[model samples]
Target: MLRKPTLLLAFGIFLIGACANLIWVEPKIYMPGSTEIEVEGHGINGPVDILPRGTTAITISHEITNAGNSPVPAGYQITETVIQWVFQRNIASVGWREGDPATHTIVQLSQSGPALDPGESAVISFGPFTVGSCGLFGETLELDSTNIVVESSNQDNEDKHLFFVPSNQIINITANTINGTLYHKDGRTLTHQFRINSGGAGNQWLYTGFSWIATEGSTADAVPAPTGRVPQGPAPQLINMFVTPKDHDHSPLGFGPSVKGKVTAISTDGCVVKQKAVEVLVEHD
Candidate 1:
């Protein structure tokens, strides 16, 4: 027979072993670092149709699931997700205009305050928020965890997609001054004038007629305009004038020569030209 003390000691050891086994086998969940939480499920839906200067409701839903087995601590808070509007290479957190749904458009479908349990999940819904004209917009979801991951609809399977639209208006061209003896290749000097249309940037222009040559001046810096030979006729014409926004080396509203002309001379003041008598390029507003 075992002594009472020996028996008690044996029982205690057995209990300790059992407890250790339970700890080792029982599913455990650990809190994910701030960087560990990954936000996905944007392009889960296809491209959203947007109207020009109009607002549309869009739903962006995402899921937060615990990949780990351990239960996360209680009372962990998930902050609100943010959507960014990217337009014409510009990004803003706010909507394009007032009453626009796209601006800070966040609708919480579920509470983000509670600590998620192991193998549990959370769902978030944003928008019905307005989106500005047809263009690219990106959404990023952030969490209170140390491991934060951001996902965007523009990104797919590690690839990025761009959303952009062509401007409705065509390019505008303007000649501040045409101070030169415009001569045709046949050596006939003639008078010339330049004009431009008013509108947003990136408009296109079409020219027909005599070939024109254009050069940039110190203050007359402008983009190199497209050139073509003038059609043979009483009136020569050039077609298709393409204009882009002001570039560092180009005009503020887009500038280029509309006629096919030879560079007779270029001085610090301006350029001298010889053309077959080109027509003034037409501007599409």
Candidate 2:
């Protein structure tokens, strides 16, 4: 027979051995980082419609989710996650507007706050803030392009499914200077421009005649003078077009309350092809 203390000791040893076996058999997974994150839109661009306005606030939110099969391990942690906007060119050479997002700072979230459990998600809010200058540069002194980026312990967060979509997509044809006011007094002479552009994109041609529509009087009476060609732009990207003043195209308020200018153009088939209307507003001042 065993003494009472001896019996108790033997039972305790059995319990310890059984517990050890149970714990070891259980699977301990060590995937310390997030596996997947959620962004609302497709491509590298956060939202297809988001454009950086000089003063208007724009919001970009990304959901960081733990997509692993198991919880983050005890010893390992995600130190930080970085969010930023980047401007890039097709070629490797750095661009004039390329680098970090100027108006906004790169966001860094510390993982020290809490351990991420598998399947749990956190939404990272970037901005309800506006951006500053677009950093545009062209022969006509216009345009800028930028895209979004998110960085973390995982590279897939920022680079996954990259289409490099632009926040703002400009129309192939753009007008720069109307020169004079939309609303102008009668009998005043003014000068203005319609810019034809192609940075080696293609050959673009206008539909010859540009005309204005007057609300009050006949189109003929509204435009006392006809359209004429105007030359403009910097070297290499220089574009020339048929431009005119509002007074010449649509006289003034006697013709009506307002006037609108309209013309059309078609690009050469081979390069960057498009057929679109070119328009501008000239008011009575």
Candidate 3:
């Protein structure tokens, strides 16, 4: 058994050692970092650019991960993300802003309670922000913009994305001459060539689909016309379609004078219509 003073001294020494250990030992350090690139919409495979017509606003999504060995406290769940957009047409300028053009936009993208544990990831979506114009546009996203989070690495906190919106003249239509003939009509089949232009990034017609209609003004033939559909492939620049005039009259419109006709195309998505007139030479038997 130890004496009272010796026991007291031992207890004091133990306490001192405990205090030293508590003070000197390193505390658990956690850091939240963004691992995936920010995308334009909610879905992972959503379009980054080539937005549909009449799209005035959009949303963005990104993933954050706790890359440390410890856990992040729920108390520090405040969001400090910043998103900025700039027009990229002929001249670069500021994109559309909701209220107070002078003020910047701050986004909140925090998850619900339950602290973020190590190796855990959380996905957050930000915005319904304006889509300034129908042209090339650029935007920047910076996570932890306020610098409130103590991160081991700050280099990966920023990302940039470019998107495009097309004007009303998204596609161009043209009639090509077939085999030396200005506009050839084989039997009753009238062939016309069309070229679909992409709206900077993706073909706008691909999403909505397209159809064509041809009318012969001179003869008013009552032949059934073929149904039209937008062609799909790896990348299609030009497409040709054969149209038949509806049955009505077989009156001779004269070969030398040519057959005056018009081709009309309408997009399935927005009902955008484009018309092209052509003169064809028919060798009717």
Candidate 4:
């Protein structure tokens, strides 16, 4: 665990309508000392950088302080405290609700200590817990806590942490002549060769099809067209599809004139669910 600067991004809300005033600071967790990287629109904070599969990036270290002018009053001494998670969508909980299972308490301290003098402080460390890799690679850890707010200083007790993970699938492609013919004579065809590699475990990707923008006067036939749903492979998968045109009369394009096509990978595997995408350029001639 690395020791780095901590962020104190805070917020407060007041409501007098049918609803009530709500004040909260989203919870978050990350590697010991990672950069402040965030994904947009997830929450107040963005996601951190991590691996696609199972990885550990959760940590918590918070301080409790007594900032009163004098020693904490006997009646106002801190009493109960807790640290836990608040699931916004309740995905893991049945009728899934935020803060459900009531048993999800990570830490609870009642009558934790004797009265402390002013300017005193205490430290609490909750975890270095293990988090599995699942779902899209972005937001992951979020932590929330509720403490008896005898002092206004501790009102901010929420932290929404986002764990950022990158794509683990690796793919390589080199443009080659189609049907062993660089230029289509009269009855030859052109094709693009794709060499794909799934780098880590559970990295299977399915080739749904290819999407491209063609100029008005261009005409070419791409193998495994949009309707072709070819399974990518286990790991280090090799595939050949039709798309690139031959160079001039000797180009790979079997039917149309030489054309450079920008290709985006389309898939319907776990890759799609995890928001992983790969793009390549296939040009011949």
Candidate 5:
């Protein structure tokens, strides 16, 4: 038989041990920091069309941003895969060439200096890539192109651009001068030529606007009439016109002596594709 005091003490100790076992404690979970990479189109620096038998240089610029909460390690490589599609020439309908395959050119760009912090951005440029003459050329640039970077999402890493290459000829404008000098005298006529060398793949129809302006502070004896938005085509066409100068130099209508002939080619969407301007200095002979 145990003493009363000792039995009570032992029971109390057991109750305390049981109460401790009943108590519940929550656990703390540590989630890892996530990293995300993003690419956006910045700007494109190139011509809309490449001349026949000539190559055009193209450059694509983009901005890379760290979109997640974690930092991206420095020296990590980012890849851009470029796919080129060449269009068929002389096709009645818009079509792409079958033989010319998409060239999966892989270009690698690396992060320099310190690691890219969260919400940080960097500008990157790719190519001055030489594109040969074709009817139309299309390109798709996929960033993180190789899936090399472990990002939060890979869906929005692509950008696309286009170019038109004239297989037959290029849109051109020129003037004819007997001895390389065009004298802008009253009643003197100058011959101007506009050549529309038309066949292209993507954008077949081009709108050209012609205007003549005199440089500021000089007197212009004559101004040519505007050729409002002429649509050019698949068939080659050449236009010749003459501009005769009035006695504007002595009148208030004359602006300047230096004359500039500006020809602008625009697309269907109102985008200026090509612009050519030439200035001539005329003296009273």
Candidate 6:
């Protein structure tokens, strides 16, 4: 007969072995709808440049992983991704403080072009464009995704999945003038001398001429229709000045327009723009 202590020891070993095997065994394959989606990335926060009637480019990227075991279904697709700038006062749990709500606006930065794959990732780029009306100083950037789907080769295995992944980083962009010039069509000449100043909310002050068409008067009256002014005609009032950092540096003058502005100033905490505030929007071509 086996000793009592020996039998107990054997039982203990058996239980441990059973536990180990259970841990190694694969669990039931979860239906796509049954599993959760995961997204990981650094959030965008802080000051972003807002140029009136101008464009700017910004790059956003992140990694998406399939936390669940098993292939996330053969026909799984990632439909859409978007980034928006939000102005809120609550402190983020991820260790970032939201910006003040009084003087800010949320703008959608970019939308994804194509669907993503299971356990796959991508980087999205959007263009240079004006940041419409609202000011965006001390704002917070939020990344989100939508319309995720999971399908399989089998006719009956189609499943729909949808979710969002938010980040904890803020976007900070500064406005700086790259180059400016004035052009005169009538004189057939260009002048590089022009003074530019931040016109608040990304608008700049420059000199330009305005023209209007002359109306016909009663022929019976004095003066012959005032000479040069055509009757209800269209004339070009050339506003010679131009500004930029356009992608290409080509111009009839052998160079592009000039821009005059200061670089974006960062605060000590690096969460807001110093001495400047403006709203921004992301335009994609």
Using lDDT as the measure, the top candidate is 5
Residues 164-250 of candidate 5: C-alpha lDDT, one tens digit per residue: 443333444444443223454544444455554434433433433455665433322213232234445556445443444433354
Model 5 CA lDDT for position 170: 42
Candidate with more favorable, higher lDDT: 1 or 6: 1
Task: Rate residue 74 of model 5 by lDDT.
Answer: 59
Stretches of candidate 6 exceeding 4 Å from the true structure: 1-56, 70-103, 109-118, 128-144, 150-285
TM-score of 6: 0.22
Candidate 3 lDDT trough over 10 residues, lowest sum: 20-29
TM-score against truth, every candidate = 0.27, 0.27, 0.35, 0.33, 0.37, 0.22
Global Cα RMSD, each model: 20.8, 20.6, 20.7, 15.4, 20.0, 22.6
Local error of candidate 6 at residue 195 (angstroms) = 33
| lDDT by residue for model 4 (1-285), tens | 223222222212221111211122223224454444332222222344433333444554445445544454333322222322232322231111223325543333333333546666554445555444322332222112233324434433333333333334443433444443333333223445544444444454544334333322233444544222344555554444443332343335444333333233322323221212222222332
Superposed model 4: Cα runs more than 4 Å off: 1-36, 42-53, 56-59, 67-70, 73-116, 128-149, 164-285
**What stretches of model 3 exceed 4 Å from their correct place?**
1-48, 75-114, 172-285
Kindly list the per-residue Cα lDDT of model 2 for residues 108-217, writing each as its tens digit.
Answer: 33332223465665443334433333322111000001111111223323311111112221224444443333433433333334444554433333222344554543
Predictions ranked by TM-score, top down?
Answer: 5, 3, 4, 2, 1, 6
Q: For each candidate, what is the lDDT?
A: 0.30, 0.30, 0.41, 0.35, 0.42, 0.25
Model 6's alpha-carbon lDDT is 0.25
**Against the correct fold, how does model 2 do in TM-score?**
0.27
- The stretch of ten residues in a row with the least summed lDDT in candidate 2 is 138-147
In candidate 3, list every pair of residues with a backbone clash: 221-246, 221-247, 222-246, 222-247, 222-248, 223-245, 223-246, 223-247
Q: List the candidate 1 regions with Cα displacement exceeding 4 Å.
A: 1-55, 80-111, 132-134, 145-285
lDDT of 6 by residue, 1-285 (tens): 579989999999665443100011111121111222221111333222322211222222323333222233233332222223342222221112333344433333445333433444333333322233232222122222222333222222221222111122122333232212222222212212222232233321111111111111101111111111111112211122222112222345543332222212221122222221111111111
